[model samples]
Target: MEKIVSFIANLINTQKQFIKDLKELKNHKDIMVKDDEKLIQQFIKKKAS
Candidate 1:
């Protein structure tokens, strides 16, 4: 019974950590997307000129 409880606790902690890492990864993706958009726009403007 105690082992079962400990296993559940560990599983919950692992899930929480996974969630935290997933959020950070999502934020990083967003930042990269914005940067790419800006670069594309600049390239377009330079090409048009």
Candidate 2:
């Protein structure tokens, strides 16, 4: 019984960590997308001028 309890606790912790990592990754992707958009805008302005 003790072993089963410990195993379940470990699994829960792993899942929580996985969720946190996924959220961080998503935020990084969002920032990269915004940066890319700004670069594209600058390129367009430069081309127009």
Could you tally the backbone clashes for each prediction? 0, 0
Tens digit per residue, CA lDDT, model 1, 1-49: 9999999999999889766654554465443544645645544454478
TM-score of 2: 0.57
TM-score of each: 0.56, 0.57
Which residue runs of candidate 2 sit more than 4 Å off their true CA positions? 29-49
Candidate 2, 1-49: lDDT as tens digits: 9999999999999889766654554465443544645645544454478
What lDDT is obtained when candidate 2 is compared to the true structure? 0.63
